[model samples]
Target: LGDLAARRFAGGDRAGALAAVEEGLRYGGQAAGHAPEYARWYARGLINQGVWLAWPLSDEVRLPRYPLGPRAGSGPSAMERAAGERALDLTRAAVEVWAALDQRDPVNRRGLAQAKVFLGDRLAELGSAEEAVAWAVDAEGGFRHLLRAAPGAEEAQEAEEALDHIGRQLELRLRFLSFDSLVSLRARGLLPEPLLPQAVVAARIQGVAEPEIAGGLRLDAEQVRTMLEVTPWLAVWRFEVRGPDGLWNVQGHPSHGATEVRNRTAEDIGNELIRGFTASADCPGEGAPWRLLLWWHEEGDPAGARFRAAGGPDTAPEGTADTPS
Candidate 1:
């Protein structure tokens, strides 16, 4: 029934596809209640239904969508949001059943990590950053154990890479969403006028370094301390990303000598930060980077460019001109 639903949806019959999935879910639910031996298959069905509901129908059945929410600036539509929530709930229930029955199974471990990562992403989209971080942390811990236990397994490797990507995104989201970071961007006129008040206050509850807050907002350290005394939510996390490669790491910048603004607002800096990490370059010699290929962080890399390069809209290769096909 699930396979039929997928095919129907791919054929552009969304209503029929949904009806087929409903029938599959009904059978799966009945089996879960009556036949203990078929629980694993039932769980698989639930997970598949959850994924189908959360994603758009495409002709390629094997290709999977990113389990995370949409990009930073936009959000899922109402139906998408509801489907995502349902998927998370169904996945959680399925995982619980798997945990009780298959504690040491590799399939269960991977499934658990994937579900947790998706749950974290959904929570973050719903404005629950702290809860989202907690879910990501749990997923990271599981992936770390899997990596150590099965060094050569593709599942373990994939799980580790997923955690790495999730960690990077969560860091960016935390920094960008923080109140102090948004205010700093606003003060520097980097943020759009409407987004000035949309800072994430999660860091406020955790408290922040006084000097770091001052540096970000271009105020004296004492002034930052004074402000924190009254409105602690104004405390900020120092944002810094520095490297020269296809891969870059983000870290918290300390307050010492941190006042060099590149004459660009924080929005420009943020965009550049994304561009730097996602950009492709020629290799020093004949290696991976030098080949005629594409560079991408992942299917869901927020940088968005999967071909040509990052930093700007894509273009034809240097010697070629773009022409309508």
Candidate 2:
């Protein structure tokens, strides 16, 4: 039924496609609940159902639907949100079942990573920025590990690219204090219109210089500089963990004696800092002491040289990314 639904969706049979998916979900749910032995088969069905539901089969723009911000109604339509939530739940459950049964299955792990990126995209569309970033980070870490393990594998590179795309999308959401602000600026001619809004936003968030931004959008440097000057600047603050197994905290102090301190906490400082950072059985049990910092700045400073240490190790390695919480 899920296969039929996918075919129907591809064939432009909206009614048939939805009906088929509904049937698949109904029967798949029943099988998973009633038959313990057939759990794996049912899990596969759940994955298929999720794929069909979440995949963009129509011309409609799914996630990141325009007019961002709380004022623009509650994020995605009710039906859209419901479908996305269901897809995430089903895919996550399927991944969990596969993980428990076959820890070393590369195929299933890759599929799980893809599903996470897909779910993360949906979550971002629904305006869950922090959660979306976490999911994207997990997928990126998995893909990075796979790429490292199998150098030059096409699938690993593809997965890594997908993770990067999702990361860029999440970064855009984080940079935009309000989506409406971006649109309004563009309308006022302060920001040059770009063909790929996501690309422009992503480059801007990464804080590339005027020339880079201009080349990225095929605009002149002067225009890019003008956009930067007029664009509303929102500081991208991150909480990074260094070392230790104990609880750690990060506090943000905005310049000029700000009363309210914005802070984020990391439960496990060491493991949370770096994705591949792991404890070895042969090594001593003691964990390294990690530092945290707060950074505030406008966009378009020199790459890797933009961030000033509001806090953290004075000799922290240059360009070392703090684990984004």
Candidate 3:
């Protein structure tokens, strides 16, 4: 159903696109109990339905049409807001599914990391930065473990770059209070928007009812906890929207799928994420509004050009360390 809708959307069938997602949102939920595959259908269906293709593959998906809520400078349309809200709900479900899986399984560890990372990015994009940051940090840790198993592989390098970005973001939050010292901010990512506003941080991180950037650093709940634990001074802001090669963009796509994000734990985390989104059709969740966001985080690594030849958007080389030893 979603594939048909995506085909229709790709063919410029707006009505078909809408109808497909509509049915997908519904039936996909219903399938959770009786059919697990429907959950996968929901993820792909969304990409196809929401993704408005341009002439080139690079610009295939239309960013503006996405369901993300309104920004300060912009107000979302009724439908876009609704869709964004729905996407947010479903994406959260997806997170639940993956979270229930075991992470220590040697053979499936890689997939677990990948799923967490993918879900984190989608959550943040869908309007949950705090949640995304938390999960992404964990994903970074998971990916680091995988990289250790095969330090020479291209996938390991890719994971390293991604971990670096996530780490940077984590550090940025850790150093939110120090964002104004000029030199302090410079020490982190490209001097944060000098005037990015403390309000943004206050409003973003959770449990930080009131946020203040003392010495250009946020003394938020999480940071405070870290501070109490003896880990003080924080630095870095790692979020990439650019690329380095055919694989230049430093963001990943949802289609990269379970193994890459799951860190080889696809069967477990993938199944869980599927269940999370699927459950929305009933009880604690209602919308079953399944949603996902996929992108590669290249972190501006110069070696990306060569990596592109072998790992471009259309190509994901099978990792040599994938034998599941």
* Cα distance off (Å), candidate 3, residue 102: 4.3
TM-score for each prediction?
A: 0.47, 0.46, 0.39
Better of 1 and 3 by TM-score: 1
Q: What tens-digit string does per-residue lDDT give for candidate 1 at 19-91?
A: 8978887888777766544676677766666666656411154222332234323456677678767876876
Q: After superposition, how far is residue 275 of candidate 3 from its true place, in Å?
A: 60
Tell me the whole-model lDDT of each prediction, alpha carbons only.
0.48, 0.48, 0.39
Error of 1 at 49 (Å): 2.9
The segments of candidate 1 whose C-alpha lies over 4 angstroms from its true place after superposition are: 33-37, 56-81, 175-325
For model 2 the local lDDT of residue 199 reads: 29
Candidate 1 residue 287 Cα shift, in angstroms, is 57
List, residue by residue over 90-164, the lDDT tens digit for candidate 3. 545654544444545533465556556655545444434444455666777777787777655677777778777
Q: Give one digit per residue, the lDDT tens place, for model 2 in 1-325.
A: 8678778878978568878867776676676655443555666666666665655421264445522323332345567667767777877777675555443656656666766676666566555554565566667667766676674567767866776686665545444332333333344433323323442433454444446556645667776655554544333333333435565433233211111111111122212322222232211223333332322232221121213222233343223322211
TM-score between candidate 2 and the true structure: 0.46
Model 2: which residue pairs collide? 242-290, 243-290
Cα-lDDT of candidate 2: 0.48
